[model samples]
Target chain A: MKLEEFKEREKRRKFLKEISVIAIGTAVGITTYLICLITHFDIFGWNFGLVLSPLFAGYAESFLAKKYLEESTGAVSAFILFIITVVWGFIISNPTLGFNIITAGSIIIIIQAAIPTATNYFLIGMTLAIISHISGIFKKITNFFYKRYLQLMGKLNLDPRIIREENAEEKYHFYETEPDMNHLGVLLLTLEYLPQGKELIDNKGIYEKREIFTFNQREELKSMRKNEMHLKLMASVKKTETKALYNLIKELKNDGCNAVLNLHMTFETLGQDKGENVRQIIVRGTGVVLADKTDS
Target chain B: MLLSSTSTLDNKKITKYHGLVNGEALLGTNVYKDLFSGIRDVVEGRTSTYAADVQNARDEAFKSMEAKAEALGANGIIGIKVSYNNLGGTMGNTILVTAYGTAVSYEK
Candidate 1:
C-alpha cells in the first residue's frame, strides 16, 4: 500500500483500538467502583476510574504521539499522558458534578478544587511524569508483584528473569472491548494470541504483500487464538506488547517485504529457538502502527 | 418550511399559528445488520450501526414533520419536541420516533 493509504489505515486502526480500550477500562472501572460502594472495600482508596484511567490514558497518548518506550520515555511524554488522563477524568466526572455555571456554589466548588482536586491532580501529574523512569528498588518491587501475579494466574513458571499480572487484567479488558470496535481494519495481537496465518490470509490461500484482505477475512481473526507458534513468536518480538507487533509489521513493510516474507520474518525468527511452525493467516491493510521513527 | 427547535422565532411576526403538527417514524432491522451491530457494540469504542440507524430514523421523522408543516401552508415550525421510544421486546430492536411542533405562517 502507498504511504498515505497506510497512514490513514493505521490512524483509523489505532483510533478504533484506543477507543475499545477506553470503553472497556471505563466499564471495568465503573463496575469496580460500584462493587467498592457495596462492599466498602476500597483498595488504595482509589475510585475505579482513578485506578485504571491513567494507565489507559498513558497507553493512548503513547499511541497518538507515536512514541512509547518501556521505562525510558522522558518527563514531557509522561506529562502529556498525565494531562490526557486528567482531562479524561474530568470528563468522566463532569455529568456527576452538576455545575450551575454562574452560581455561588460553583465558586465554592472551585475553591474546594484548588485545595484537594488540584493538589491531587498535581501530585498525580508528577507521579506520572516520573512513572516511566522508575528504577532501582521501585523497579524491583514492581517486577516482583508482576511476576507473582502471572505465576498465580498460571501463565508463567517461576523464573528469576521476571517482571507482570496487570497484563492479564488488561487482556481481559481487551476481550470485552474487542467486538464493539472490531471494524477498523486493525490486525490485533495480544500477549496470549498470535495472528494465525489461516485466519488472516486471503481466500487465495496465497501470501502476497500489499494484497488487501476484506474486513470479513480480518473479522475471522477474532477466533484466531494462539497456538504454540503464536506464543513463541510473541516472545521473540523483542518488545512483547501489542504496539510492538504493530511496529514490527510497519518495519517489515517499510523494508518492502511481501506478505510471505512478512509472515516468515515475523514468525520464523521468533520460532527459531522453539522449532515451531507458522500457520497461514492473511490480513488486509496495514492497520495499527507503533512509531516508525526514521531517526531511530 | 423553516424549522426551529427553540420556542420563539428571531425578529419575526407571526401572522397565523396553526395547531401542533407531528410526525412519527418506526424502523426495524434485519438479522444480519443486527448481528453485525451486536458484534460492533462489543468491539468498537464509539460509533455503531445502531447509532446510525437511529439517526436515520430521526432524520426521516423530521422530514415527514416538515412535510406536514408545508402541507398545512405554514412557512415555519417552532418549539419542536422530539421523543424516542424503543418498541421491541426487552432488547429494543425496534424504535419509534415522534416529533411535534407548532406550525405557523410568519413575516420576518
Candidate 2:
C-alpha cells in the first residue's frame, strides 16, 4: 500500500475504535436498564420504578464513564446497574425491610466480590445488591443531614436583604446585603491545608538561604488544575462568595456606613494534598464605618 | 560664534518623549518586582486560578492606566495601590484587582 493509503487506513482504524467504544457504552447502558427491570423481585412493597432507578443510574453512570473514563467494562457497568436496582428496591420497599435486606446483602456482596472465584456471577450480583441497599440508606442519611444543614444556616441569622434607593430623578440604586454575622464572619474565615510534596535542594551556589523544601515543583503536583471539573467547582465557589459579599456591602451601606474597609488574608495549612480535600483558606473581612473624617 | 535660533517657538521648549517610554520611566523598582512576583505566583503552584485571574486583572488595569497616562500627556504614574472586596462563601476565592497610581509629567 502507498504511504498515503496506509495513513488513511490507520486513521479509519482509530475512528472505528472510538465508534466501537461508544457503541459498547450504549449497549451496556440499555442492557443494565433492561436487566434491573426484569430481575426486580418486588420484595416488601417495592414498586417497579423504585427498584429500577438504580439500573437507570448505573446505565447513566456507565455512559458517562465511557465518555469520560479511559477504561470501560461491561461487568463494571452491569454491577453498577445491579447495585442501583437493589438501592431502588430498598427505596420503594418498606423502610424496615429495605434497610435490613440492604445492610445484610451489601456486606455479603462486598465480601464475595472481594474474593476471587470462577463462578463470580452470583457473588457479583449479591455485591451489587448490597451496595445499592447501603447507598439508599446513605442517601436518606445525607438528605437528613442536608436539611439540618440548611436549617442551621437559617438559624445562624443569615438575613439577606435588598435595599433600593430612588433618587430625585426617579433613578434607583439597588443595594443587596447579607447580615448574617455567623455565616460571613466565622464560617468562611477558616482555611483547610493541602500538602503537595517535599523536595531537597543544595544551596551551595545560592544566597544566604541554605535549603528549603518548597511545594513548587511541577512534577510533584498530583491534582489536575486545568480540568473542567475544577473549573466548575471554582465557578460555583466564586458565585457564592460574590453573592455573600455583595449582600453584606449593601447592608452596610443601608445602615448609613459610607466607607468600607476590606481586609483579605490567605494562609496555607500543614498536611493534606491539593484539590477540594486540601485547600488554602482565604479570610476576607469588611469593616463598615461612617465616612466622617473623625472616624479615620 | 554660535548662531542660536531666534524664533518664538524656541521659548516653548518642546520635549518629545514616547508614551511607552514615559510609562516605563514612571515604573518603580519595587512595583515592578511586585508585578513580576504576582505573575510568577500565577505561573507557580503558590497561587490558585483566582490568583492568576487577579494577576490578569492587574495587568489589564495597568495597560488601561498606561493608555490614560498617554492621553493625559503624563510621563509616569507613582504610588499605585490595588484594592477590592474579597466576597466569601464558595465565590470568595475570586480576587478583584484594582490599581490606582499618581500620573505625573516629567521634563527632559
The DockQ-derived docking category for candidate 1 is: incorrect
Model 2 earns a TM-score of: 0.22
TM-score of chain B of each: 0.80, 0.46
Kindly report which residue stretches of model 1 are placed more than 4 angstroms away from their true locations once superposed: A1-296, B31-38, B42-46, B90-92
After superposing candidate 2 on the true structure, give the runs of residues whose Cα lies further than 4 Å from its correct spot.
A1-106, A109-122, A125-296, B1-48, B88-94
TM-score of each: 0.26, 0.22
Candidate 1 residue lDDT tens string, A153-264: 3442211111011122233443242231112233222111112122233212222222211122222232222312112221222122223334445554454432221121
lDDT of 1 by residue, B1-108 (tens): 788776566577666555345555544432233444544466462255556767776787688668867877889877676766543321123345556666677986
lDDT of 2 by residue, A69-124 (tens): 54433334335444554555456543555543444334433433464242245435
Q: Who wins the TM-score comparison?
A: 1
Interface C-alpha RMSD, model 2: 22.5
i-RMS, each model, one decimal: 26.5, 22.5
Each candidate: RMSD: 37.6, 28.6
